[model samples]
Target: MKSPENLLKSFFAERIKGLVQSDIRRMSRECERLGGINLGQGICDQPVPDSVKEAAKSAIDRDRSIYSKFEGIDPLRERIAAKMADYNGIRCDPDREVVVTVGSTGGFVAACLAFVEPGDEVILFSPFYGYHRNILSLCEATLRFVTLHPPNWSFDPADLERSFTEKTAAVIINTPSNPCGKVFSRQELILIASLCQKHGALAITDEIYEYILYGEHRHVSIGSLPGMEERTITLSGFSKTYNMTGWRLGYAVGAAPLMEKIGLLNDLLYICAPTPLQHAVMAAFDLPPSYYDQLCADYARKLEMTCAACDEAGIRPLLPQGAYYLLADISGLGLSDDKEAANFLLGRAGVASVPGTSFYADPEDGRQQVRLCFAKQDGDLEEACRRLRGIRTARP
Candidate 1:
């Protein structure tokens, strides 16, 4: 008669049992309990556009709440296809190459299921969005890590070349990256594209932070590169761009054959994305280019404000080029461990942040860093900054 915990452990697979829950959520909960401001999660702390909301209401009123096609509602897919061509520079047939997903998270997982065979190798640049690593593990793919060193978070070409092998199946690229906010330059993308082509491998990119650029930094999709479109599966969503994280609307664009498999897997996993929300996302496509321009400008101001707060708090930060995250080096605080520094910040300064350890495959890689998200409302950013300033005087 084993205990219930032991019984559950016995029944669970190693992949499930071995999974380490990231400290981000735990710290988020602690922040809520202490009434502290949470800068840990990279969620936009703003209201979604009214037009998108009204569209959802309209659809529901019109009895469009029923199940949509597994690939997604037709109009939404058509819009996404047009968007891919216009923005990403990838020409895709909506009916054949687009598959709507629950979110980019769903798209990534579906792509993994569609392509990854057991024991196949998947390359991931470290300090990656943590979810991507977990999905690869579930697919039983062996991970090959190429670390993006900090300061610039750039990779050495030779180091990258050595990471691929005969078993290489795919590489996950998250440009406008998380935790560090390093936008992959076009030259870098070309370097990666060359390797993937040489290895006969695929590139599955997570471009969720695609539109959140800062000054002089432009996003270039690798899929748009010559000969790369057929080899790349682009996963992105409306979460960051339109403050629609809760809408759970995302899509995948790839070759027709790959998208067909992804659609079948979506059917098996989720059946379809939320029906009315799909209609709502279609409204987002109508927003003028000025809406995007203002979005970048607003976030740039927030980035500067937060960086100033970090300086006042004695946290040396790497200024971001695209996404709204700041990775502050915590070594100056005389703390060798990020988890300790994060807990101290939350407890003493009432500002919650994610330990950089949550982003890396090896805890040692991020032991002296902490990540704070700046995608907050104006008042929230001000409060968070005010609270963080107290760190300068607080006893370690």
Candidate 2:
């Protein structure tokens, strides 16, 4: 008779056979065990706005616990539509084109399920967010990668153009990218849009960090490009902008025809996002423009502090154009690879970071790097910075 482990392994589906928790979660677990500060996961340990919290409380008091329409509450959809037009420059009809989801992640899954099939080819940028890669894999889509070179994290246009083929069904774009905070420029989006149009491929974008920009970098939704309105599915959420990651509220916007299938998948999978939280996130849109300004300013300061600490510790910080993550080169640490460097940092400095291997397709590409999250509270981030700086002296 086979052992219990072998029996369970044989019963599991092929798609999920080799899947495990990501290195980000693994590092966070180890950090927790050691009582170390975790910069591994992008948890955004900041205070949620009081108005949003109060609105949730008010909704609960009023008994807003029933399942909502699978697409979401009308008021929230209307707000999302208004914001999409004003901020993202993509005009959409809330009633037909919007589908509120469990998170932007849910939107991505729905998009993948609705559009991708076995033997279809998808183009992805390397140093990608792990969820995007894994979800596409789970759907059995063949991925062709385009590398995003470091420093600015820009891709070669020739490489991107060559990635398209007759089998290309969709391309996944993550602007203000995680791990490496690269915001795709408008010119780049225009180029991508032209290719998608040429190849008859759809564009699926994740723009969850739309508001967390730095320097002169701006967020551009490819869906807003002249020819992309019908071909692009835009995904974003209140989680990053309002410091409400646990709320699990996000939405997708696209042409009505595409959204119909995505909405059905959402209905089949989740029924609806949490009812009361949907009501509460409506308050988030009411925040003034200055609120966004301050959010950027606060994150800019955090970025500066964290980058300085990494420099002091001899890890060369790759300055981000936007988003809250910083990827640093750990080659100077005299370790064999990113995993060893990460473990050394966690053990020596009591600060946890994700091994860079988590974000790349090839292990060698990330062998000398690690990613750090700076979206932390002021006191906690300061402590983390101090601990990181101590690594300079702690090294043998």
Candidate 3:
């Protein structure tokens, strides 16, 4: 008889072959292996708010560890609904239009599964968050990419319009985007919303970085646009805002009919978000606006520190407007590509960062850039900066 590994080759689905762990996670592991400062993944080293933690402890002590409703626990869902109305300029009925998910990542996957069919076309911006592409591919959807150019990372409205067709099912918008940190402007989102409307496409947005804005860069949900509320699925979570990534709590809001399907799919997949974590994040929303103000103030200082370090090393990073990421131009490093530069930095400089190719559809688009996260603790970030300053001299 054939061995189990050999027998599985014929049985594995084609989709399984294209799947791999996220490069960010891979780089984080490499950072660990080398005992280097990790700037590869956008994980917050900041502590979760004390109030939220206290709430979690209270819930656990009260034995609230049982399964929640398929949508979510009512208290958390109600708070999320109120938040949507107050902050996002949109209204949702918590019991009908919202469903808690494992994370925004899970929300995206559930939205894709709820709407896409095999051979359907999904529009994605180039330099997109990689997980979005992975979910779409699993749905067997044909991908149509619209390139976002460098520096500003903006595209012509006509170019966006041309990418959509009658067969288009969805378009993913990641604002305050990962890797690049380019927050989509309101005008740009309006343009995209118009195209999605014209094509009868679903606008599946990832607003996970909604709160981490800097210096006048605002986050506007495409779903908030006129006439778009019916066609958009908004996904966000407490992971970034509350520094509760491990809590894995997220939620999705959409039209009642579509959200009903997503709720059912959530039942089939994750069943519900964590009960204790849900209770914890209910307190997260109650945090004073001063808490978020301080968050931005803190990250801004970190961003400047990292940018200064890159300057000392003769690298130019695209300064971010809303997130804690820095995508630096590594073309001056005398290396062949971003991958080699990233490895060189890891091995020689003792700092880890993600290669830009991980974010683009065509590798060439990202060949000149590398992404680093500045969300580390201040001392770790300071150390990362110090190490990075020596990359040029250390690369013998």
Candidate 4:
């Protein structure tokens, strides 16, 4: 008795039935339709470093286009190992502990598949990245959310302690987090480390925005914390830092036993990441320290500009200690909810933003907020800012 559409839906797995394009992608499509400036998605449209471009060209010329070792090329893994030791303070073996992935998202998928199962419970901080939540859902793991209160996005230690129980299998941490931008401090990490050790649960961290910090915040890897070296899977990539998102290069570092299963999953899923791009990203590591210093300084300026624009539009910008996102309170705009606020910005200001409800488990938590990405190129960001500042004039 089913209709054709119902029959087609019945053919698909129940796990995927609820899935749809995220608000980030949805707003991006709407922005394209309206010829609006997109501040919704975290697409860093900045130019990739010239050295990295030349390296890719050189690799192509030398015909380094074959499938790489499933764990990635040796040289790239070595560079990642060295970077982890120096930057993240995590000592890892390139041969045994590191697996270059399609992207950090790929690594996350592999990790979820390798460890998570139907009965397992994964603890995620609320106001989480949508991919993280959805991926865990696909793995059929029960998710326990601990709320990250805004303005500062700090969570109470007692709440975190309660989230862990005998059923806990893993906890995902995204420092310099997306949407709100909370960098977990060493003291907080130590507490989390203690919980993981006590509950005998694994820790999976996403550190893609480790470099794009502002003010006095410092990046700390949970894997480097005491008693966590063997229990933590650390994920990061070249996309955000080196501005090569299209290249689809990233990596995972953890103890050999855990990485062995993740490596097998990576091979089964992706075969391998792009070969020539792996050779090229080595050039990114050679860039000077000044390059990183400049990266932070540039983002700090962009943050200031975007925050000022929001203030002018009567939106209260919640300042981030790190990352290139700003979550602004739109209560003063007289909008019903985040979706309305987002549409108002897009339709009137010619600037698109993601509804804040997209980031939380409970929609009401982000009812009056919208998240904006300031990671655009200077011209696009400035134009977006100008559009946002003119929003008052465009009000109905």
Which pairs clash in model 3? none
Tens-digit lDDT string for candidate 1 (93-193): 99999999999999999999989998999999988888898889888999989998878889988988999898999999998998789899999999999
Give the alpha carbon lDDT tens digit for every residue of 246-336 in model 3: 8899999999999999999998999888887887789998899999889999999999999999987877888877788988998778789
Give TM per candidate.
0.98, 0.99, 0.97, 0.99
**Scored by CA lDDT, what does every candidate get?**
0.91, 0.94, 0.89, 0.94
Query: Which candidate would rank higher by lDDT, 1 or 3?
Result: 1
Cα TM-score of candidate 1? 0.98
Tens digit per residue, CA lDDT, model 2, 1-396: 999999888999999976899999999999999999999999997999999999999999999999999999999999999999999999999999999999999999999999998979999998999999999999999999999989889999999999999999999999899879999999999999999999999999999999999999999999999999999999999899999888899999999999999999999999999999999889998999999999999999999999999999989999888889999999887788999999999999999999998899887789999999999999999999999999988986
Model 3 regions lying over 4 Å from their true place = 1-6
Cα-based lDDT at residue 212, candidate 2: 91
Winner of 1 and 4 under lDDT: 4
